[model samples]
Target: MKRSSRNYAEGESPRERIVNAARRLFGSKGFYATTTAELAEEASVSVGQIYRLFTDKDDVILAIVEENVRVRLAEMHSIFDAVERRELAMFEAIKAIAANSLHNEDGSLFYEILAEACRNPTVAERFEKQTAFYRDGIRRLAALARPDVPAAELEAYGDVMMACFIGLGHRTAMSPPVDPEATSHSTACLMMRALGLAELESGRVQTQP
Candidate 1:
């Protein structure tokens, strides 16, 4: 199973340890710069163990991406649940999701993955698989949106959300911190308005759908 976090405790499985180490090392160093030997050393596992658990460095990166997508989907589901329970407004949920997209360093990892994928066929294939996995997650989220839109409409929402969220990651990495909350709010409003879940009042977006 993919880990929800990178924390490793006593008696953690070798595969889990290896994945966690790879996540950290890959985050700190470019994918091309990190070698299997370094991964083995950081994971506290033998090179043999690394190979036994994963096909190669590409496989390790795939595992990391899969885990990241799983966590994001779970968080999105929880936010939706909160909205259903009336504990969170739909606008608030969108803001939460957008803020999360802006807060992470996934953009750097994304570019690093692209660079590695260009040089290695296996990495390219793995990247494609992980992207499909994330795309499916987005489709599920779109299906769950309020007012029960048609399949084509849901697909459009998912497409817009995915593209904008990925763009936000790049924006976060490139831009200086300038009222992140304001940026997140506007982005959230855009998504909600597009989804037909927002109504404007007093020149401000209402939390309700």
Candidate 2:
């Protein structure tokens, strides 16, 4: 109950304020537990303004998740681009991408949204959109890493890799890694092996000397 609250309206638009307030309140309280009145109060906006900006609290939650996905997808694109341009190594890119997935700073907010997705078709659709992007990206990465492999086979690898990243986010949210860098690198290795793209790296493998 004793948590710091930020000025939800500090230079943000009415809609942004409402979404921000909902993210904090819904994450802390819950979707059904929090009300429009509470969102209005936290956002420092009139109740009417909240309604005008969003159809309901569900709308605000959708906005929050959509924004989150948008930023994350952009980052993914950047990492994929770097790999394509040879600006980053394939292993390093996978490690960077896996590390990015572990950022769950909002704690249970991600879980709350996941629950919301299960109950709400619209929210679920947004989640599906994110999954499609990730799956496609994985398939593309696989093709580049193992050009000899057929696309159909790579498609299956993409689905499994996507699941791994998604599950990793949920897992790390509950039990954070002690050494995130090591975790990410290990994840990269596992994922690479999954795509038949494994490679040997010195000093990384545990050498029982």
Off by over 4 Å in 1: 1-8, 118-126, 143-149, 178-180, 199-209
lDDT per residue, candidate 2, 1-209, as tens digits? 22225554346787777777888898889889997788788877788888888887777877887787777778878987887787877778778877887775565787887798899998899777876765677677666665665777867766777787776666665874647688888998887666655455631222121
Predicted candidate 2, C-alpha RMSD: 4.8
lDDT of each: 0.75, 0.74
Candidate 2 yields a Cα-based lDDT of 0.74
Clashes of 1: 0
| Cα RMSD (angstroms) for every candidate in the order listed | 5.2, 4.8
Considering only N, C-alpha and C atoms within 3 Å, which residue pairs clash in candidate 1?
none
Best candidate, TM-score: 2
